[model samples]
Target: MKKFIIGLFALVGFSAQAAIINISTDQASYNVGDTITANVWIDIVELQGSNLAQPFIGGFVMSLMADATSLSYNDGSIMFGDKLGAGALSALLPVGFGVYSIQSAAFTPSVFTLQAGLTSFELFSLEFTALSSVSDALFGLTASVSEFGSFVGTPVSTASTEFSVEATSVPAPSTGVLALLACFGMMVSRVKARR
Candidate 1:
């Protein structure tokens, strides 16, 4: 009985320390001039032996790196997750070429807290426009979370994904355009037949 209790405590402690940061894009490929959206998610194991261990999140900062030449950061496109709640403060700053810093925090301690359970929640999202064609372009994301009460910061490992951008192709004529051209051609044919 003693050994079983010790083992159970160990398992709960291990699960409590487990957290993951995930980054994902809307699509695996894009065309030049297409908008690309990347989402950041955080999954925390909050159930510690049937009790919720939800932490009060003070703030978080995320760094994103992309190919500047092939992708243009869409200014003012950083959106905070709903879980952060309204009245949250946020900012987007350009760290360097093709690099950006996204920061967000709750107004007060009671504003933002991690939800209980194993559910994965979105932290934020960013948008970029494909400027030029590139093969196997990579977008890298890393982040850190700050606990409000403890003031302890935990760094999340970097997550990255690769995608391709193809050159934009010329669009074919639309059906409306085709119908207009056909009507003009018929009018011209009638005029010539009358002559």
Candidate 2:
């Protein structure tokens, strides 16, 4: 019975170290032509009172999907976070359509490892321009970490968020402005007739 209890505790400790992916935007809503900044984060903190050491990640591949019609991805706007450490190589792979793949890895396995800690670290960020107003502009993400400390790979849960875009309103012309425009039109017509 004691052996079974120990095995159960080990299973629970292993599950607690799984990474979590998070997606967030700078604002709750946006307007047409406005820029939106989306940030991706990974949380690998171990559960409190767990004896297992936090696992470090050597690299990660993340794919982001956005509504192409409503939000246009900004070229050259992919930025990696410092947690990846120096000498980390990254690339922005345009998969065509509306999916973007971001891959980053340490040049040398021993050069750096996303250190284990009690907090989350920023994985990367992307920028997009609001093309048109939409009730819900959806963004989706899927990611996995490779070369985890002594482990082959770890899969992170998929995450998504919705953004709203509202159209910018143009003020209507006032009555006085409309009357002035009519007077100007009449004077121009009169001059043209004289000529």
Candidate 3:
């Protein structure tokens, strides 16, 4: 039993060393409101499956702020495709190590508009909080951008393309203004008659 325990400890240390997290963005600097897409992934190629479902990977969505007063919340939703059958399963990259398919898609140009002048980094939370489950511990995360009117594109190795959303807050001329002007003209005529 003592020998078995020692061997297990060594194995665990080796496995932990094998697991690493890598994050990359297409663009580094983003405007306060610019919509940017980022990709996250891992390096392992094979994972053994368990008979049960497991959470192997996930990510934190955040945006960098320009200033305290210049930051605002950008609202968006996350959707995961290619749902796997729940069970003890091993995950193999559709491609190979350091390569992966799109597990989730993010709508870009940001479906949500940010507050004007609020330049800060904000993380959009995931709708599906669970990560992909594989037989082993090698896990990775990635993001696909879906701008305001578009959908996600094909998967790639790196995340890039950082930008900002411009705030549009102009009020158009209202019918109320025209009515006020007419009323003022009528008052002026009445005053002129009295004089």
The candidate that wins on lDDT is 2
Runs in model 3 deviating more than 4 A are 1-76, 86-156, 172-195
State model 2's lDDT.
Answer: 0.80
Q: How many residue pairs in model 2 have overlapping backbones?
A: 0
Model 2: which ten-residue window has the lowest total lDDT? 46-55
Candidate 1 backbone collisions, by pair:
none
In candidate 1 the C-alpha lDDT for residue 114 amounts to 40
- What lDDT score is found at residue 18 in candidate 3? 27
The C-alpha RMSD of each candidate to the native structure, in angstroms, is 8.2, 8.7, 20.6
* Model 1 per-residue lDDT tens digits across residues 64-165: 899999999888888888666676688889999999988887765444444434366788888999999999988998888876654556786678888999
lDDT of each: 0.79, 0.80, 0.33
Candidate 3, residue 141: Cα displacement in angstroms equals 7.6
Alpha-carbon runs more than 4 Å astray in model 2: 1-19, 46-51, 108-118, 147-151, 175-195
Count of clashes in candidate 3: 41
Relative to the unseen true structure, what is the Cα RMSD of model 2? Answer: 8.7
Q: Predictions ranked by lDDT, top down?
A: 2, 1, 3
For model 3, give the 10-residue run with minimal summed lDDT: 125-134
Error of 1 at 133 (Å): 0.8
